[model samples]
Target: MSPALVNNSVISDMNTQENSEQRYRLLIYNYLSHKTTAEEKEVLLDWLKQSEENRKLFSDYKKIFDLTVSSDQKSRFSYRKPEALKRLKSKIDPSVSDARRLKIKRLKYYLQTAAAAILIFLIGALTSFWISRNQSVQNLSITKYEVIAPRGGKSEVVLPDGSKVWLNAGSNFRYGADYGINNRDVYLEGEGYFSVMKNPANPFVVNTSGLEIKAFGTSFNVKAYPEEKFVITTLVEGTVKIEGKGLNLSLKPKEVVVLSKESYEIKPDVDKVTTTSQLSERTGRDRSEKKEDISFSKSVQVKSNVNTNIYTSWKDNYWIIESESLRNIASILERKFDVTIRILSPELNQYTFTGTFYKETLEQILDILKLTAPLGYEIKEGIVVIKGEQKRKSIYDNFKTN
Candidate 1:
């Protein structure tokens, strides 16, 4: 027999199965055609309950049938059961051995199984493609917004969650559109005073270059200047948790945590000092090698009587300097005046000045420095040059009266 004749004989044998089996096959066909009567659906449900294999086979056949008869394929090629049967019969030669007919029956089974497997693979591939495409769209929907305070300028911004932020001169703040909804996250460069709104469930997080500050309904000041070697976080109200390198510390009201760029000698009596051993324990490093490899020291939590206003007064348009070095003072003036300041004398850099300037011009502030410290400043264009003042000799001294 030819392959088509043998395949027809196999189909005939399937139709000659027990009544229940034949009814099950007919129910599967009815489901594929979407024309199952209520009684046929009930019978199919009972058959599916007999075994897991039965349910799986039925599902695979249903998928294959749906794919074959889909509208796109139907428009291109009309498939009719009678036409398919006629084509098979016309192609078959009715003179062959039984052995050849058995082989043809096995081939028909393999072809049906392969077709079902291919349809399943295609469905899975399309599902995965759509899932990835939707994820990309979601990522594109998240927009990032950045606010910058120019040199000698200060800005105030309101976040999407109604939190208020005061950005100091030369500061930058950024947040995304999904900030409050998914996560209240912000990145800060330079200084910012945040008055966070209380949402205990979603804590507000402020990320600096080296530290992360998590706060809940709190007001705090973060000073992390790129030029400076320290990142200082001061909590004025509520509470905040600070994390950096291998340190995690919590701050209360009027508490300050300082993160330095250099390792310092650990003292026994210091307040909440994180030692090299503690760092090694957290980071899984040899204590000796850890110290040398770590650029930033463990955070130092200190209790001081120093006025907090000196650190936070800049947000109110006031510069409260108290015994701060001229080098540090010059840094402030540069930002306040939006000008470049060069100190010619290294000795002058250490001279400490204490005063408060409110709405003062660059020349006026420079004059105040001259009287308090033996420094002379000259401004040409936008740069200010500061040098030590020279002393004048008296006429008697010049004549060598002694």
Candidate 2:
């Protein structure tokens, strides 16, 4: 064949194919709108039967048709493409500024607009779908969330698994998005009162500095401050499994466990291991050596049938103290009132008191304590200075001796 004849034939075939594509597109639109004549419908049906690709293409157009037009649009056909498409575009892809993408002229004026609306809406929908997918992927990489209750105030938080936590003053609590899914674990620093929701399969675990309190269905209180010498776990209702270094205890209802922070360790030259309290009692030991020899305590003391209110009452309006030391109570008062306490008289730390205080001011509480013992307090710029009244204390001491 001649080269010129071959080129002419190829051009004719390209024009015919382009015309065929436009015709088929128009016919499909007419069929969807119910405006196709009997002859046009026959032509479309024959074309659909010609190839599986043709049928697939028609099916794809049908999906766009169904989404853009209402189901019952035969009798009162209302075109809602303009407003609905604008709303979808603004909400999903307002930043899309490509004018060429929106200039699609598939059908006549109304059809043209409808086609553009459908295309833009699809792009927006797919874009939002991908953005949401990326967001969920990013969330999986993140770890946990920390919630804090600063000094002088308490906070009540509801966990993702429907468990309730009452964080005491100067407390920190943390959990993650996978809290209720993979595992129900929470990290607590300082004191917290937990009312856990029961899930037999996914047990709730409280991770403190020195202990892990696991509960299947229970309510409990944990006090594990770093500066304190002890980590106290009090069980109110249900059972809890407490685990620490060389200590594993299952607490029953109305029971309390105290784990001392001072571990038993042997001095460098000494053969026998002694408790931290015993080491502190040593007469001639250097202060630096004592610190170096101390380790995390494994001492666990469990008391059954104990008063749980005394330990957990800080959450309530009234605080109950049952023979608690004044030195220990100073820390509680500092956290409760958001103040610094300076106990100048070292002897006053040994003073123990048992009482219940309800809505008492700091000064009022101090006054009440003064009435009970030879104790004097002075408040200066949010700091409370506690000192012993030597004269009165001496008189009381003489009276006791007599």
Candidate with maximal lDDT: 2
TM-score of each: 0.55, 0.58
lDDT of 2 by residue, 167-227 (tens): 7777877776567888998899999988787899998999987567899877799998877
lDDT of 1 at 189: 93
For residue 43, give model 1's deviation from the true position in Å: 89
Model 1, 1-402: lDDT tens digits are 233442333234544447546656656876666666555566577878989989987888788787887453353234234434533563584342221221100011111111332111111112212222434646565556666665666666656555777788778777775679889989999999887879999999999966689998988899988887667888877889887655666766766666663433332333223442333222224333434433344445344333566777777677889878899888877875567899998878877889998866777788898876667888886788999865512332455576
Taking every candidate in turn, the Cα RMSD to the unseen true structure, in Å, is 34.1, 31.9
Q: Deviation in angstroms for 174 in model 2?
A: 0.6
Give me the runs in candidate 1 sitting further than 4 Å from their true place. 1-140, 262-301, 392-402
